[model samples]
Target: MAETLLQDPRTKYPVPPFPKQHQDVPGRQSAMQPVPDCGEDSYVGSGKLTGRRAVITGGDSGIGRAVAIAYAREGADVLISYLDEHDDAESTAQIVRDAGRRCVLVSGDIQEQVHCQAIVQRAVDELGGVDILVNNAAFQMSHKDLQDFSAQELERTFRTNVFATFFLTQAAAPHMAPGSSVINTASINADKPNATLVAYAATKGALQNLTGGLAQLLAEKGIRVNCVAPGPVWTPLIPSTMDAEKASKFGEQVPFKRPAQPAELAAAYVMLASEGASYMSGATVAVTGGVPLI
Candidate 1:
């Protein structure tokens, strides 16, 4: 994996790629012509989450995959809740195991409360307890006009984006003690506001709020809550979720003229989850490629 010019196939390092990557469906990470660079070799870990357990939704690919690797390196056993992306989930689990920690893959939709509860219980039963929870799974579709967005699309987007966050956090929060962390994946579009992804962007706004309220609600328990608002990132979501033209021009408008790699965003997750960020909560880390206006 290291022999070739390890890049995200978008642009220069630390800046992200311009053209988006991935498909609109459950895109296969390994099938990507030029896979996203997840900063495995460069990611350094401290014993922050040693002996801890983490439950990360969407841990199968993209930023979730990178975060799982980082968490394993930092000494946390991870349980992943994801859609049926079997190969990607297995591959990520292998990386976590190789990093010398246990990786439990929990496949299901967070749209269901039952599934959310079961996922938390499985993490506790399999990994001992849940110390960290990251609500990172999401889905989106593009539409030129508001009327073009079907009711089904709006419901599905919100169900996965905002509703899932609330349900999973509700389940995991009880199991988490002091020093536990919850990181929600917000989006730059929440602040910047994109016209194309109206419903999806709106859901992100709710997620940002969820982060804030959860931080306060969990403060009494000594658990910290925060968010990572990434800009145009080159992840499987791009290819699978965007139209062909949109996918090809994924990150053209960013000041850096590129999209962020899933690996680049992984560090933010590690920072928030680890003890080094003990005092931080309810804050958003803007990882957009210098979207100056946003």
Candidate 2:
């Protein structure tokens, strides 16, 4: 019998010290160094999500983009909500379309309750109905001191990370029938908070709590709610939010000694949205590269 080949996780993707780089807020995936691998050509689908309609925020890049690609390949039509990353969103849309799935693009700030509600409505109006909601959008900034964080910055982080999740869930829940899934993109910071990322960590903690509560609340309705707590992932958010030095050495603290490519995070989202996870809810699936989540 022939033995199957195995790939080592540590050596699967690029490692640090990566080239120091930076981008403004809501970074473009096209501009990242080495760019993130979103499984554009790698993921294979088996119709796990056939006939399902999905709404994914921040679908233009990073983990969201990877999920969009995976979901589309899995036979799900997707609606991507982004904050003015036109080029990135269009690229993702094209990938989905090429996969023979309808990809609707909506660009705006999810921080607003109205906008979050609008995203769900758009999904219902265009994609038929919402069967999966991936609350993958987020905002963060590193500050050496709490005092260094302006009130506006703090508010923006919470509004973008926490408030938007709440708004989108509330709006989408009505449109979602039984067997639907709500997947939130929490972070390892929820369990192991980073001092420099105090506000972002807080929001992630809130997401975990929200996931647990919503899972129980929606159980009777047959809608599962869960979260993915990823460690350092090589996404546009890294260079745009962290300092150059930190960005260069990103994910070094993890046992893997390297950040995860966005593609690495897609499978979790796909499983959670699939029937395989029908009995799983309120669970925080940690993809922390061997970093245990307390």
Candidate 3:
């Protein structure tokens, strides 16, 4: 038998205690000190999602971008929805096109129900139909005190992180046929709440609950709903939302000394979106670097 090569997870990627850095909200992955490895070169697909059409929110960078690349290589045409990150979005689109799949870009605020609906409509009109819907876009800000959170800030966080998922799913459901799948990008914060990220954590908890309820609701239609709960991942969101000191030390708390690269999380999203997950609905697959979610 040919020997299988195994790489140790702890040292597979760069370890933290990284240099201090920062970017504005909805950070650009290109500017990070160690730009996240979103599997631009390494992921090799086996046609798990052949001929499928997918819509990915926040597909410009981070986990979303990684999933888009994987799906494209796996023979799926993708529609990427993001905020005003044209450069990043273009880069992702190019990669998808390089994989010989169609890539459509939609830029707007998902907090608006109309925009969410439009995103789905665009996919149906452009990609032919939507077989996979990935609600991966989110907003987060670090605040030490709950009192520091303002009414507008709280509303924006919930609207972007929680409400948009419902709006997008509701819009896409009618257009999605049986055997379609919906994958929500949840977080470890849902189980082990982060004091400084109370609002974001609360939104993720709601997503997990929403996943279970929606899974049951959609089961009758042969649609599966699931979520991926990730721990510390080295994405632009860390340097942008966290203090420089905190960002430098990100992921040290996990059992794996370093944070996961966006590439590391792509497989989970692909698995949930593929037909193999036919029996896997309402499942919360934790990719938390050894952190138990219970």
Clashes of each: 12, 0, 0
Q: Model 1 Cα displacement at 118 (Å)?
A: 0.6
Once superposed on the true structure, which residue ranges of model 3 sit more than 4 Å away at CA?
1-4
Model 3 lDDT tens row, 1-294: 988799899899999899899889989999998999999999999999999999999999999999999999999999999999899999999999999999999999999999999999999999888999999999999999889888898899899989999999999999889999999999999999999999999999999999999999999999999999999998888998999999999999999988999999999999999877889999999999999988
Residue range 1-294, candidate 2, lDDT tens digits: 889788999989998999999999878899888899999979999999999999999999999999999999999999999999999999999999999999999999998999998899999889899999999999999999879999999999999999999999999999889999999999999999999999999999999999999999999889999999999999999999998899999999889999999999999999999999999999999999999886
TM-score of 3: 0.98
Off by over 4 Å in 1: 1-11, 14-24, 292-294
Please write out the lDDT profile of model 1 over residues 1-294, one tens digit for every residue.
558865544456534233445454868777664677776676777877799899999999889989998999989999988999998899889988988999999998888889999999999899989999999999988789889999998999999999889998999888998999999999998898899999989999999988999899999999999999999887788788777667767777887777777888988998899888999999999998777434
Model 3: weakest 10-residue lDDT segment is: 145-154
| TM-score, every prediction | 0.92, 0.99, 0.98
Q: For candidate 1, give the lDDT.
A: 0.86
User: Over all chains combined, what TM-score does candidate 1 have?
Assistant: 0.92
